[model samples]
Target: MQAEIGLIGLGTMGSNLALNIAEKGHDIAVFNRTTAKTGAFFEAAGALRSKIIPCTTLEEFVGAIRPPRPIILMINAGEPVDDQIEALKPLLSHDDILIDGGNANFHDTIRRNLLLDGTGLNFIGMGVSGGEVGARHGPSIMVGGAQASYKRVEQVLLDISAKYEGQACCAWLGENGAGHFVKTIHNGIEYADMQMIAEIYGIMRDGLGMQAKEMAPVFAGWNEGRLNSYLIEITAAVLDTEDAETGKPIVDIILDRAGQKGTGRWSAIEAQQLGIPATGIEAAVAARSLSARKDEREAAEKAYGALGETLKRDAGPLEDLELALLAGKIAAYAQGFAVMSGASGDYKWDLPLPEIARIWRAGCIIRSQFLSTIAEAFEGAEKESNLLLVPAFVEMMSEAQAGLRRVVARAATAGLPVPALSSALSYFDMYRQGRGTANLIQGQRDYFGAHSFERIDRPGAFHGPWAMNAG
Candidate 1:
């Protein structure tokens, strides 16, 4: 009996995904650059060995699968993916499917799709989220490719996808790059969420003189309520873990330098290029960049002083921090979706915003009860670009904005860095204003760059000489 599908790359994600497929009763043929990894996988497979056909080379991997074959590339993004596809291109027949399940830049996906346009071999840029454990169990699958190609493998994809309430958290977002684009923006929002949480943690530690032990229960409590999420739950667990040697909180001993694999930066960059304000996401990216300059920070601390050492802790406002977090979260999601909405129109992807929200409600890292509200908000709407304008979210924002304002004020006064939270509040205020200070910017642009500005009173573009620079 031939395997129904094939996978190339037996890394953690790929191997687990193959196991999942095999467990679902679908025979899978898998290949890897290093045959040793494949050997190890087969050994671990044990009873499942009969289900997974191990292949040492691309030709063998292709030969093992059935016709109209769907092969997933869980390999690294960029040139490596191209290399694999090029090697597999000669072997794959017409109507065969090639799926890229990695954190690829959406632009690259579009380019690759364009490159494979006339080849007859289909290309799918798919996003798989939920980390290592999620792979072994099930992961949220976001697919973007030709609709016909997607139709061919829909059932198999659905079978392997994470299910919530008996429905798969997988769907075809659009053709060419939509899935990766959505995933990119998803990571951006994740960065904002994590940064805001860290800012709150900062408030607890330095601002309120609370230790990890004292603060862990607070996160655990939050997880039981509106903030219930995998990230928050794991954060509490991370804080709860103590080092084996000194018994100090593991997080305290860990370096503050956070690592990123570029998706968050891409999200911020795309938003900026689109002329959309994703300040919350942008702030998070900037914070990580700043954190990376550990030496400079140490020097600055030595030369000047630590903000925590200098600033006085006024009110802890633990409950207010929760409210502020919720507000920031709403704003972050609003911005992320706004970017997606803009891209959908610009690229004519016709992305289903509501469906995207639905899939994200579970199986992804950013999964939260809040996503349900987001889905509901999008579903009930007449289709708008921004989530904040949705009636449900509008009311929620109105009620919770005060908390955001108060928290930002407290953090500012305490000389604490709350860039993500501050940016969210600023974005909210900027979004609500009928008239903003942008007129001065327009005037300056026209004065310096000869870029004409449109007058609100009339409809024509106008330029400012400004009294010939008072010469």
Candidate 2:
């Protein structure tokens, strides 16, 4: 019997995804550049091995799948992916679909889509989230390509995707690069969400004089409330763990610095290009960059004397911390969705905002009960309206903003760094202001360069009289 689908790159993600497809009753042919790994994977498959056709060569892998094939490339995102696509072009026949399943730069995805145009081979830039565990079981799949091409593989994708209340967390997002773009923004929100949580952790540790064991229950308790999510649940679990060798908290034994791939940075860049204020994501990216300069930070801390240690004080009630986190999260998600909205307009993709939120309600790292609220907000929202402006969110922000303000004020006084949270608060403040201070900036620009400014009283652009006095 012929295999239903073929997959390349039997790395961690690829191997797990292949198993998931097979477990869901689809025969999958899999290949790796190192032929030994393919055999090793098949050997490890055990009961599911019967459904896997291990292929030693690209030709064999392509041939194993039936005609008008659907092949998923789970390779690295850059040149390696391009190389694989080029190698497969000759081996693949007309109507064979190629799916790029990686954390790709959407721009690159668009280029590859255009490159494969009229080749009779369909190209899909698919975004797969939920890491190793999600791949082995189910993942949230974001597919982008021709509608017909997506329909060909839709059932298989649905079968392998996570279910939220029995509905699959997968959808054909748009054409060309939309899936990757949304995934990039997802990572951005993840960074912001994590950074805010870390800021709260910093407050608990430095200001409240709390240890990991003491903080564990706090986060665990928050998980049962509005902040209930996978990240919170795991945060509680991680804090409770101890290092076996040293008997110290496992988190204390771990390195302070964090590592990042390019997705968070990409999200910031794309937001700036589209003129959207994704300050929460930007602050998180900047914070990560600062964290990476560990040597410089250590030297500076020694020179200036450590402030985090000296600023120990009361951090207010735990309820305030929880509310602050929720508010910051709302701002971060709002900015992420705003960036997506801007990109949709720029690309003419006509992305379904509500559907995007609905699909993200499970499987992804940032999946949470909060997303259901976002989905509901988008359902009744005007096309160009911001999430902050949505009535439900306005009511939420009204109730929650006070807690955020108090948290920021306390963190500021205690000299604790709360970049993402503070940035979110600032974005919220600026966005809601009917008249901002930017008119002075416009006046400065006009005075120096004769650049025009628009009067609020009138529609057309006008120059400031300061240009007349410039020599």
Candidate 3:
């Protein structure tokens, strides 16, 4: 019998995803450029080996799949993806679907769709999250393609996806690049979340003089409360781990520099292009870039002295820290959703905010109990409503904002850097302000560049007095 679906690339993620498909009782045709790796993958399948057809050539792989085939390319993003698609195009029949399961830039996805427009091939920009383990068992699958094309493979996707309360964490979000765009924004929020958490860790370490061993339980406790999520749970485990070689805390021994594969930056860029402010994400990206300047940082520290020694302050209650994190999280998520809303309008994708939240509640790295609340909030909210304006979150922010205020104030006084946290707090403050200080900015713009400013007292744009004095 012909295989139900086909997969190319036998790298770690690709191999695991193929096994996952096979484990779901659907026969899968798998091919890799390296034929030996394909044999190894089939051998490693063990009990599920019978369900996977290992093919050495693209022709064999395409032939093994049934008509109107759905072939997933789990290879590297960019040129490799384009090259692979080109190789498979002639082999695929009319309506044969090609899915790019990589962290591709959304613009590339759109361009690829246009490139394949008249080729009788269908394309899907699918964003699969949860890493290697999730790929092997279950992943949060975000698909962007034609509705009819998605309908053909929806069952297999749902079967292989993670579940929350028996509902699959998989959906066809929109046409073209919506899935990848959402995934990019997801990483951007992830960066903010992680940076805020790390800032808290810095406070505990520098401000409170608490060691990693002492901080693990604190994180463990938070996991049982509102901050509960996969990231928090893993943070505790990571804190508790000791370096087998040096016997020091693993995190301490690890380099402070973090690496980026471009998704976070892409999210921030897209948000800016869409005229939405993702301050927390921008701060996190900036933080990572700054962290990479180790030599400059070291030199600056030598010249200016360490920040922790500049001021001393009593640490606030741990409850304040927890609440502060929650508040910051709300701001980051609110900004992320706002960016998506803006993109939906600009791209005319009509992205479903509620379904996006629902799928993120499981399988994805950012999975949290908080996402369930977000999903519910979006259900009844207007399409353009900010998440902070949702009644439930309004109450939440009302309570949590005070804690955030205290934390930012304390961090500032102590000369501790909490860029993401501070940015989130500032974003919240700016968002809620009825009268902002931007009037001065408008005046400055008008004085220098003849830019007009709108007045609350008048309906039309008005020029500043400086315009009358211009030479």
- The 0-to-1 C-alpha lDDT of every candidate, in the order given, reads 0.89, 0.91, 0.91
Off by over 4 Å in 3: 310-315, 381-384
lDDT score for residue 82 of model 1? 92
Cα lDDT tens digits for candidate 3, 1-471: 799999999998999999999999999999999999999999988999889999998999999999989999999999999999989988889999999999999999999989998999999999999899889999999999888889999999999999999999999999999999999999999999999999989888888777899999999999998889988999999999999999999989888898998999999999899889999999999999999999999999899889754324344547788999999999999999999999999999999999999999888988987898898888873633798988888999999999999888988998899999999999998999999999999989989998989998869888988787986
Q: Once superposed on the true structure, which residue ranges of model 2 sit more than 4 Å away at CA? A: 308-315, 381-384
- Candidate 1 achieves a global lDDT of 0.89
Question: How far in Å is the alpha carbon of 74 misplaced in model 3?
Answer: 0.6
Which candidate number maximizes TM-score?
2
How high is the lDDT of residue 199 in model 3? 93
Could you estimate the TM-score for every candidate? 0.96, 0.98, 0.97
Residue 404 displacement (Å), model 3 = 1.3
- For residues 120-182, what per-residue lDDT tens digits would candidate 2 score against the true structure? 999999999899988988888888888899999999999999999999999999999999999
Model 1 lDDT per residue over 309-333, tens place? 4234444487788889889999999
